[model samples]
Target: MTTKEEIINRLNLQPHPEGGYFHQSYASAETTGDKQLFTSIYFLIESGNISHFHRLTSDELWYYHGGDAITIHMIHPDGRYEVVKLGMNLEQGEVPQFLVPARTIFASTVEDAAWSFVGCMVAPGFTFDDFELFKAEELLPLYPKHEAVIRRYAL
Candidate 1:
């Protein structure tokens, strides 16, 4: 029964609130993070730490924590994404963050080292009861096979 403020204070993470899932990392006590109701963060690939592509709710948000570059694959109604890439021009000490909306399917890459980030589900908050994961099985398989990734999200 730890309060969000208490948890934030205990973790010593600032309100980085980047507005995007690629904003920051919440776990591992390594980077700035956000407060989520039911959403959870994950360290996808090791060499790249990429969180696969998947769908999301209309109120989901994400922030970037660490890494060199990330590639986001948006699932179109036609069963494919536009391959939107983010966080590629990030340099040392010049990190930036962006906010994300729901119904967005995306992914990130670390390449040289392990990268991580945090996320949040707004409105009713994220929960396993309201959580879903897209594994490309239900999606239209017509994109780069390696990019059709799926991750956990709250709707």
Candidate 2:
């Protein structure tokens, strides 16, 4: 079996802005006039590290590849909190793929596993300008009901 370090080195993954290790794997040459159609990346988060709360201007679709399961926590614009499990076990209620709508605050962490390897695809591509990281202090008051989670995951 391949190790996490091997995969990280092979993919040239670097510390992502949101707290995981990631490297872009694809970027469509085709564009919708100006913007690229989509882009994809290999994302990995080890046990104990969480993907901090952040949002993107474009929709992001997550695809589970291997390793362990991850729990994606999302806080919608309307203040609804949702959890999505990404894994291969159908009987265990894990979904192989899930979509996170644009502008929704989201974070993730490996659940009871050594690590998690997944793919993230963003529509209309992705740019540093399109990413927004949340500060715990700023989000706490706004979503007080989710204080515990926000504090735990926010950067």
Candidate 3:
């Protein structure tokens, strides 16, 4: 089995601000307005690490590749909370792909394995300007019912 360090080194992934390792893998040359049509990356999360709560201006599509299952916790703008499991076990109710709409605050963690490897593609291409990391205290009050999960995933 490949170690997390090996995967990171092999993929030339950098430390993602949200608490994972990632390397941009693709960027379309075609532009839609001022932004690229799409962008993709290789993302990995180790067992003890969590992807912090954040929101993006563009919609993101997550694809599960290998390793452990991942649980994505999303809090929609309407104040609804949803948990999506990303894995290959269809019979066990794991989904292989999921779409997160623009401006949704979300986070992820590896489950049932030492690490997880996945891919994330964004329409309108991702930019630092489009990313917003959440502060637990500030976000908690907004989603009082999801306070526990917000506390667990927020950096």
Report the Cα lDDT for candidate 1.
0.40
Sort every candidate by lDDT, greatest first: 3, 2, 1
lDDT of 1 by residue, 48-124 (tens): 22444444554554444434344444555444545533453555333344444565554444445533333433433
What is each predicted model's overall lDDT from 0 to 1? 0.40, 0.92, 0.92
Residue 32: error of model 1 in Å?
A: 26
Model 2 residue pairs with clashes: none
- Model 2 alpha-carbon drift over 4 Å, by segment: none
Residue 45 shift from truth in candidate 3, angstroms? 0.5
Clashes of each: 23, 0, 0
Q: What is the C-alpha RMSD of each candidate to the true structure, in Å?
A: 10.5, 1.1, 1.2
Task: Give the total clashing residue pairs for model 3.
Answer: 0
Candidate 3 wrongly placed segments (more than 4 Å) = none
Q: Residue 39, candidate 3: how far off, in angstroms?
A: 0.5
Model 3 per-residue lDDT tens digits across residues 17-123: 99989999999999998899999999999767779999999999999988888999999999999999999999999999999999999999986546889999999
Candidate 1 weakest lDDT stretch, 10 residues: 15-24
**TM-score, per-candidate, Cα-based:** 0.46, 0.96, 0.96
Give per-residue lDDT, candidate 2, residue 76. Answer: 97
